[model samples]
Target: MGIELLDRTALVLFSGGQDSTTTLAWALDRYDHVETVGFDYGQRHAVELEVRSVVADGIRRSFPDWGDRLGEDHMVDLQVLGRISETSLTKGMAIAMADDGLPNTFVPGRNLIFLTFAAAVAYRRGIRHIVTGVCETDYSGYPDCRDDTIKAMQLALNLGMDTRFVLHTPLMWIDKAETWALAKLLGGDELVDVVRTQTHTCYEGDREHIHDWGHGCGACPACELRATGYRGYLARQQA
Candidate 1:
């Protein structure tokens, strides 16, 4: 691996999913010190924080001497900050369990709130880069995950905080297949194994029915996106 991304400190919005996991590994490769921030905004997968903690601690064991270098992986609880909404990811909402209607999973302003908090944390810690895993392609139609939204947040963060902070969506335009390829390209097989085996990506949170690569009911929007990526990946390998 050429590993161009190394030796700088970046604050990654790590979500304990494939995309964010890839971004975390990418940051680790590029930055000397890599810190991660996770928002616990009453999402269904808030339990994934436990997942992130395990991953972060494993990273620590790998580099025992670099306590400060790894930075902190924050799991900020935003339940009170979240208002009652229709999105399945928010408080006081009935999740459809499947992407049958409007995805009921659309937490409006989710990415916005996350980025806002992340930007604040980064500025306080004097970190400038905020890495997210929002990919416009092969997603479940989250408006906040779009490229325009991310750019707008970047501008707002700079203007609001009076600092030149950069919002880096490393997986912005890439499809799920491309994201998986990135894991292999940047993080190597070992990190890829870690990511595939861990990281929650299911609305149902059914880890038992999942393979090492994907999860959930296998019919929901998240499952569909993941399945699409899985097929694409297999096709690539076979091709």
Candidate 2:
């Protein structure tokens, strides 16, 4: 199922990657005030937060018609949550198949914690909409990226906080290729270039190596998926 766009002030859960960058543009297109909230959960790809800042700045500059709707960017430190988790993302362990059939990179409840914290921050800023770039179709075996999980979290947040906040997932039903298409549609070809070069998705967080999709450690699962999707997108465009 697809999510409907919200026409209100929003808080984007910006991760400084292709997906989140696309969603930031999506939110900016629909909302008047689009603030961003990032997390420092001790993930191996912490550099993506820095990329988030650059991309956010680029968005404000590129989309001047949106005015100063790009509000403050808030970064939360959730290092304690990462310290207790043994996921490859936070711990930098080898990527292996978990006994439960999930990827080793699956950070348990990472999105749940991120959305909960983001909602708290958004509520403080009087925002009721939270936009996230999570995509179930392109996700790397992370259950938290699923739509049902997001709905459940949204309901819980509303009940707990007594606020009617809507969680926006622009990429929830789309794959990485479609996400690329969305970036183009929302912010034109320039936004696509920004997402391609500035975003970071490597589980190993290797920014030195350039690939077709972006900069990433080619061997990692994230890079492999991104490369495959970019290839697909190219083929479709050519056809």
Summarize candidate 1's per-residue lDDT along 1-239 as a digit string, tens digits.
11122325689998777788788877777777778898776666666666787666655554354434677767677886456555666645556644544467877777898899987777767776778998888777778999999888888878877778777888888898888788777755666666666776776566667664655667666767776786787688689
lDDT of each: 0.73, 0.85
* Candidate 2: tens digits of C-alpha lDDT, residues 81-171: 8899998888857988899999988888889999999988877888879999888888777899999999999999988888788898989
Best by TM-score: 2
lDDT of 1 at 119: 77
> lDDT at 212 for candidate 2?
66
Instruction: Please provide the root mean square deviation of candidate 1 (C-alpha atoms, Å).
Output: 5.2
Poorest stretch of ten by lDDT in candidate 1: 1-10
lDDT of 1: 0.73
Pairs that collide in candidate 1 are 5-29, 5-30, 6-30, 7-31, 7-32, 8-31, 8-32
What lDDT score goes with residue 127 in model 2? 85
